[model samples]
Target: MRKVGVLVSGRGSNLQAIMDRIADGYLPLEIAVVISDKSDAYALERAQKAGIKAAAIERKACASKDDFEAKINAALTDAGCELVVLAGFMRILSANFVNKWHHKIINIHPALLPSFPGLHGQGQAVAYGVKFSGCTVHFVDEGTDSGPIILQKVVPVMDDDTEDTLADRILVQEHIAMPEALKLWAEDKLVINGRKVKVLA
Candidate 1:
């Protein structure tokens, strides 16, 4: 089985989803470690509860962004992680760090990407008055949410939808989509061609 390292910065709902899938024997992989940039992030607590090795590498301790990511890379490497999943990780990674991982890193965004790229993606979609908004799982590229799209699930935007409501719905889809994407990757079924991902049957 492939080993996964999860990076998180906040509540880690997606991280929880992956853990649930693993526990239920739905995902064919092991969570080797969970790393967070914030010392006080709830994700760390979640990792501990799941009995996964967890660490907090505060970005403030590093002299530069590269240094921080280097430490993160070392931590993941030490854990024997083959895949890195970014579940609400807030930092913008440097080019060197991104290149080192290349297609090995995956991230889930709250909105159908190429639409709302950065933070508050659900709010951005709601404000823009989109009828359909959802979540996307993609390979992490140098640009913000600009990597090859792996999977996407569209959720209808209700008339009374607030940012929180929309995000909640998208989060459900993320829970499903993220694990599916990871499964595909773990099985060596995902092929990246330029900006697209081809899933081999």
Candidate 2:
């Protein structure tokens, strides 16, 4: 089984999804560690409850972004993590860090990317009045949410939907799509050709 490292900054609902999948034997991956930028992030508690290694390397405490990333990298390396998953991690990684990991890192976004790339994706969609909105799981690159798409699950935008309501709906799909994308990666079924991700059957 491949070992994965998860990075989180908030409540970690997505992290919980991955763990649930692992426990149910739906995903053939080991969660080697969970690291959070916030010491008080509940994700750490969830990891501890699962008997998984958990750490918090507060970015504010580090002298520089590089230092913060170095600590994170060391933690991942120590735990023998082969892949990195960003589960609601709020930091914008440096280009150097993204390059170091390259295609080894993946992230789940609340919006069908190449659309609402930054924060408040659901809000962006609602404000833009789009008929369809959804979630996306893709490789992490230097650019914001511009990586090759791996998997996407679409949810329709309702006329009376607010950001919170739309986000809640998309969140359900996010929980499903993130694990599916990771499963593909673990099974060696993901092929990255330039800007595209081809899934092999």
Candidate 3:
């Protein structure tokens, strides 16, 4: 079984999705560890409920940002995690930390990407009046949500949608998209060429 480490900062809806897929035998993944920068994160609770190992490492407790990442790196390594998944992890990992994972890390972003790459992606799309808004599951790189896209699911932006409503709809797609990305990744069906990701048969 392939082992992965998941990082989360907020509610772990995506993480729950991955766990659900794995439980159903739709994914060949074992969650080695779930780490959160916040002690009170609901993600940790989800992890514990699934009987998965959970670690909460506060950033302020570390000597520096590098030190913080170092501790996380150590945890992943100790757990024998081959891949890292960022499920709403808010921290921007250091360049060195990203380089260590290289193409082994993946993140789920709440937008089509390269459009509204930062936070509040749902709000950005709503404010921009776009007809379509969705989610992207991509490899993690040194850039902020600028990595090669692995899979994307587009959700139509409703005219009568608030941020909460749109995000709720997007979350449904996220649950589907994230599992697909993880399946492809574990099966070695994704190839990163430059900025593009190719899914092979």
Query: How do the residues 39-130 of candidate 1 rate in per-residue lDDT, one tens digit apiece?
Result: 99999999999899999999999998878988999999999999899999999888898898889999999999899999999999999999
The model with the greater TM-score, 1 or 3, is 3
RMSD of each: 0.9, 0.6, 0.7
**What digit string (tens of lDDT, one per residue) describes model 3 on residues 1-201?**
999999999889899999999999999989999999999999999999999999999999999998899999999999999999999999999889999999999999899998889889999999999999999999989999999999899999999888888999999999999999999999989989999999999
Candidate 3 residue 158 Cα shift, in angstroms, is 1.3
What TM-score, computed on C-alpha atoms, does each candidate reach?
0.97, 0.99, 0.98
lDDT of 2 by residue, 1-201 (tens): 899999999998999999999999999999999999999999999999999999999988999999999999999999999999999999999999989899999999889889999999999999999999999999999999999999999999999999999999999999999999989999999999999999999
lDDT of the structure predicted as candidate 2: 0.95
On TM-score, the candidate that comes out on top is 2
Candidate that beats the other on TM-score, 2 or 3, i.e. the better one: 2
- What is the clash count of model 2? 0
lDDT of 3 at 136: 95
Error of 2 at 74 (Å): 0.5
